[model samples]
Target: MKDTIKYVGLDVSKEKIAVAIAEEGREEPRYYGLIPHTTEAIKKLLKKLGEPSALRVCYEAGPTGYPLYRLLLSLGVHCDVIAPSLIPKRPGERIKTDRRDSIRLAHLYRAGELTSIYVPTPEDEALRDLVRAREDAKEDELRLNIA
Candidate 1:
C-alpha cells in the first residue's frame, strides 16, 4: 500500500471545467475530459478520481473566483489557486485550448513550476467588493457632475 499522489489541473470557465491528471513519476499527464460547472458534477468527479488525501487540485484565478478552491478544501483535498500570469509559457505557443491548458497546468504543477496565489476569505472578498463599488459610485458622480 503505497501513498501515490495525483496532481490534478483544472481549466475552469463559467459553464464547464476541463480536467487533467499527472500521477507521481515521469509519465505524461492525461486529459480527464470536461465536466459541468456544478457541485454535483465536481463531487462525482472527485469520487471517481479516488481518495481526497491523494488528490492535489489547482485552477487559475479568474472571475470564477475561489468557490471551487474552498469546496475542495472543505472536502479535505489539497487545492491551489494558480496565478495564470506567472505560469511558464513556451516560445510561440499560440494555439490555446481548454484541454491543452489543463494538461500543461498538471504537468507544470507536478514539476513544481506553478505559482499559487492567496485565497481570500469570504469576508475579505465582501469588503473588497464594497470598496470597489464605492469607488465606482464616486467616479460616476464626478462624471455626471451630480456631486
Candidate 2:
C-alpha cells in the first residue's frame, strides 16, 4: 500500500543472514529469522517478505560487499548499504548479536536515523575487483622474490 512502508534489516555474514522487519506505525520491529547466504536464499527471503514495492531494506556495509544491494535493486526493491560506524547506538548498549543488530537496523531505518552509502554499478565494482586482484598478485610476487 502507498500509505505504508515496510522496513527490512539484514545482518549478513559468510554463512547466514539474520532478518528483521518493521512496519509503518509500529513501535517495535520483529526478528524474522535466519536464512542461508546465497542468491536462492535471498530470493526466498524476498518472497517471505511479501511485496517488494512496499519494502525498503537496509544492511550494514560489511564483508558481503555490494552484491546484496545489487540483487535487491535488480529485483525492483529499494535497499541501502549503511556504514557500520555511522549507525546509532544507545548509551551503554554493549550487547551485540546478529538478531539484535538486525532489529536495531530495522527500527532505526524506519525512524530515518540511518545513512546509506553510495552503491556502485556492476561495471564499477568489476573494475575495482580487477584492480584489487592485480594488487594481490603484485604482493604475492614481491613475497616470492624476497623469499
Candidate 3:
C-alpha cells in the first residue's frame, strides 16, 4: 500500500494552538495536542509530523491571522486558512473548546468539507493596512471634534 498522507488542523490563539491529526482513510483523529503559538513551535510540529508533502494542514481565520499560513508556505507545506463562518456545525451544538475545534477541523478537512478564504498577497495586505490606518485616524479625528 502507498504511504497515506495525514491531515492536520489547528485552533490558533494568541499564546497557544490546539493541533489534531487524522491519517488518510481514518475517520477519527490519530493525535491531538497543544503547543505554544510561535514560529519555532510550528516548525517543530511540522518536523514531528514528518514529510511536508505528506501533511495537509488547516486553521480557521481569526484575530490570530495569517502568519502561520505564510510560515507553512515557506516550508512547502500546503495549509488552508478556513473561514470560520463557513464551517459546518451541527444545529444545537453549543459546547466548544480548542481541542474539540481542532479535532473537528481535522475531520472536516480530511473529508473535504471545509471552505477557505483567499489569502491576500503581501502587497495587498499592506494596502489594506494603510486603508485601515486611515479609517482609524478619521475616527479619532471625529471623536476629538465631538468632544
Q: All candidates' TM-scores?
A: 0.96, 0.86, 0.91
Sort by lDDT, top down from the best: 1, 2, 3
Candidate 3 lDDT over 23-90, as tens digits, reads 98866985479999999999998998889988899999999778889999999999999999999999
Model 1, runs deviating above 4 Å: none
* Shift in Å, residue 121, candidate 1: 0.4
Q: How much does candidate 3 score in TM-score?
A: 0.91
State the RMSD for candidate 2: 2.3
Task: Estimate, for each residue in 95-137, the C-alpha lDDT of model 2 and write its tens digit.
Answer: 9999999999999999999999888888988999999999999
Worst 10 residues of 2 by lDDT: 1-10
For model 2, what is the C-alpha lDDT against the true structure? 0.92
Each model's C-alpha lDDT? 0.96, 0.92, 0.92
Query: What's the CA error at residue 75 for candidate 1, in Å?
Result: 0.7
Which candidate has the top score in lDDT? 1
CA RMSD per model (angstroms):
1.3, 2.3, 1.7
Please, what are the lDDT tens digits per residue for candidate 1 over residues 46-120? 999999999999999999999999999999999999999999999999999999999999999999999999999
**Considering only N, C-alpha and C atoms within 3 Å, which residue pairs clash in candidate 1?**
none
User: In terms of TM-score, how similar is model 1 to the real structure?
Assistant: 0.96
